[model samples]
Target: MASKLTMTPGEILREGELEKRSDSLFQLWKKKRGVLTDDSLRLFSGTSERAKELRFHSILKVDCVEHTRKYVYFTIVTTDFKEIDFRCTGESCWNASITLALIDYQNRRAVEGFRRHRFQRAASEAEEEPESPEQRALSP
Candidate 1:
């Protein structure tokens, strides 16, 4: 039987170009190619070929700062409270895609936690319960 809990963590959800705001004094917007997977967002630099990966576990939330006729501005808040700014074409739904993927990843983690807790509780209960006569006979 197929398992509903099965999930591929590295599955690609979305891919596109984005404009990431730099940390320099001028805060120039630099173009980057983004690959959104089930567990992380990988941003590749256009000039340096370097990649910056932001895992879903570290991302706290995605905030939409503004929406203009030309672009959509958003911020990615990390677990440490650091914010990363980004913008993309008005028609490209990068922010929504990232938010949905992050939510899915978070939900998966929550389900796993519940499953683990339930399994542990069941095992403990079994250990504390008295064994049946048939079960005792089978034991070494």
Candidate 2:
């Protein structure tokens, strides 16, 4: 059986904490599985007058839904306090070029924590195992 990957919102936010503001914002985009559209790019890149106008009140919205493939798909919504379709993708698509850049840093950290927990559990189990003389001989 495959183990489940679980994480919390606090953990997700913390991962992106060290990134530059723009990159962090981009990661938020990925976390939500948002595809960057022309408008979104303009705003995110600070390239347009409209972008400048709304920059102050702009916010990223992200939603993650559990999918049938045992992975979560994130939906990203961006707004100048108004809804905008910036970027979008489906759950099973593994296009890392786009996905990796958008991943919320906090989510990455949460994943790392989960990995560490699994590793520690395995190590503890190994330490708890009883060893026979033959097993000890083989351990070397």
Candidate 3:
């Protein structure tokens, strides 16, 4: 049986607490360590077996709000309208880290998608092109 703890193949980037931030107030919920890779965020719960994942390609936007030297609040908005929120402990830059990671992931995905699309279009054009008369005349 496959374990539910299985994570996608990649290096872990950053990890920290999952918190709720309201204006000047900051509250820490479960200490969720976020593993950021080129494609996703895998959050392993510190107090439970629960895990949450957010894929960069599926994320429509990341909204980050910085408050006075104490905290940085951020939200991950997915294409499916799911909004996940988190906050950084005092002076910690978890929000910036997550935002940068997401941006890098998204850019990489976009480049790869563009390359694939270009390659496919080129291949399709080659296939659909009519053979030249000179080449046809030389065929057996």
Top candidate on lDDT is 1
Expressed as tens digits, the lDDT of each residue in 7-126 for candidate 1 is 465767788899999999999999999999888999998766678999999999999999999999999999999999999998998999999888878988999999999999999998
Better of 1 and 2 by TM-score: 1
What are the lDDT figures for the candidates, one per model? 0.90, 0.37, 0.71
lDDT at position 77, candidate 1: 100
By lDDT rank, best first, the candidates go 1, 3, 2
Clashes of 3: 0
User: Per-residue CA lDDT of candidate 2, range 1-140, in tens?
Assistant: 01124543222211110101124445453222222321222222322233222121143544443344444343444454344322223333432222332344335456889999999999999999899899889995
What is candidate 2's TM-score against the reference?
0.26
Residue lDDT tens for model 3, 49-132? 676777787888878755667666678788998777777675777767777777777776789899999999999999999979
Stretches off by above 4 angstroms in model 3 are: 1-9, 20-28
Name the lDDT value of residue 44 in candidate 1.
Answer: 95
Estimate the TM-score of every prediction: 0.86, 0.26, 0.73
Query: Arrange candidates by TM-score, highest first: which order?
Result: 1, 3, 2
